[model samples]
Target: MTPDEARTLLEQSLRVVVPDADLTGLGGETDIRERFELDSLDFVEIVERLSQGAGFRIEEDEDLRTIDAIVGLLSRGTPHPV
Candidate 1:
């Protein structure tokens, strides 16, 4: 999928975790976890949703660290686990 498509998916994933979050106002560099005050479990939820939604496995801490990274990853396709 394209970056835009991945971004859309990320927004969907974020909303799944935080229904009332202002995802549209977030920039590319936005840290979803910090911005949303998400705990580790919440982040895992986002990762799970993103992976499932995009049909890929994101099995790394770094992979889901920021909105941009998540979008970049989903856009470029899945990366093999390190």
Candidate 2:
């Protein structure tokens, strides 16, 4: 997928994690953990849902580690297990 598409998906997934939070204008460089108040469970869930939606398997250890890293991974479309 393209970066724009991935970004949109990330925004949508993040909304699921924070339905009421205002994060519409945040850029890819924005730190989600600090900016969106995403806890460990929420982050994991987001990754899980995103991976499922993207038709891939994502692991918390191999996939998600930090907010910046997660953003990079999503934006760049990291390789995943099919």
Candidate 3:
């Protein structure tokens, strides 16, 4: 997937967890957890949703702190299982 595609998927997943979040001005380097006030469970849900949308598994060990990180992971193609 491309960066744009990954970003879109992330937005959709985030919306499921935070319906009122204003993502229009979100920066790529912004910390998602802090920005969205996501608890551990919410973050996990977003990861799962993103994986499903991308048709691949996103390992828990991967660095997913920022939108840029997650987008990079998604656009890199299927990640090898650890």
Candidate 4:
């Protein structure tokens, strides 16, 4: 999928994990972890959801060490490493 498509999926995934969050104003550069106050478990869940939504094994491809990294990975259509 394209970066835009991946971004949409990421947004949906974020919403799934944090429905009350105001994601409408977020952009590709938004720091999800800090901005949403996500913990390690929440980060894991978000990655899993993003993987499922994108039809890829994200956790096995790249390290999602930061929200910027996550966005970069998604934008490049790359998966997060396990």
Candidate 5:
């Protein structure tokens, strides 16, 4: 997956979780936990969704400070145990 592809996936996934929010205004440096009202459960769901879609186990410990970084990591691929 490329960064653009990952971002599109992330945006789509995030939209599902935050349907009322305007995803177009989201910044690359926004802290999802504080900015998007996402809890750990939300993180798990997002990770699961991304993993299933990406064919890789995206780690939970990754620093997801920005959407760019999140997508970048997904594009680069992170090998984790099933």
Candidate 6:
């Protein structure tokens, strides 16, 4: 998937997790956990949703702190160890 597509999917997943989250003016590099006040479970749910939506398995150790990082991972199709 393209970055734009991945970003859209991420946004959708975020909405599913935090319906009232204010995503406006959210930067690519912004910390999602900080911005949305997501706890560990919420974060995990979002990651699972993203993985299911993107048709890929995101490992637990992946650097998914920022939207940019998640989008990059999704756009790459499949993840490999760095």
TM agreement with the true structure for every prediction? 0.87, 0.74, 0.93, 0.74, 0.84, 0.92
For candidate 2, write residues 41-73 as lDDT tens digits: 888888887786666766677635444466556
Expressed as tens digits, the lDDT of each residue in 1-82 for candidate 6 is 8889999999999999999988889898999999999999999999899888888788868999998999999998775322
lDDT of 4: 0.72
lDDT of 3 by residue, 8-82 (tens): 999999888999999998888999999988999999999899888988888878899999999999998675542
Q: Give the Cα error of residue 72 in candidate 3, in Å.
A: 0.4
Candidate models: Cα lDDT each = 0.82, 0.69, 0.90, 0.72, 0.78, 0.89
Q: Which stretches of candidate 2 lie over 4 Å from their true place?
A: 62-72, 75-79
Estimate the TM-score for candidate 3. 0.93
> 2 or 6: which has the higher TM-score?
6
For residue 64, model 1's alpha carbon misses the true position, in angstroms, by 2.1
Total clashes in model 5, counting residue pairs 3 or more apart in sequence or in different chains: 0
What's the ranking of the predictions by lDDT, best on top?
3, 6, 1, 5, 4, 2
- Look at candidate 2 and give me any clashing residue pairs: none
Best by lDDT: 3
| Candidate 4 local lDDT, 39-73, one digit each (tens) | 98888898888777766667534666554566667
Off by over 4 Å in 3: 80-82
- Where model 6 places Cα greater than 4 Å from the true spot, the runs are 79-82
Q: Mind giving the per-residue lDDT tens digits that candidate 5 earns over 14-34?
A: 777777767767777877667
| Native-referenced Cα lDDT, model 2 | 0.69
lDDT (tens digit, per residue) of candidate 1 on 41-74: 8888888887788887778565566788888888
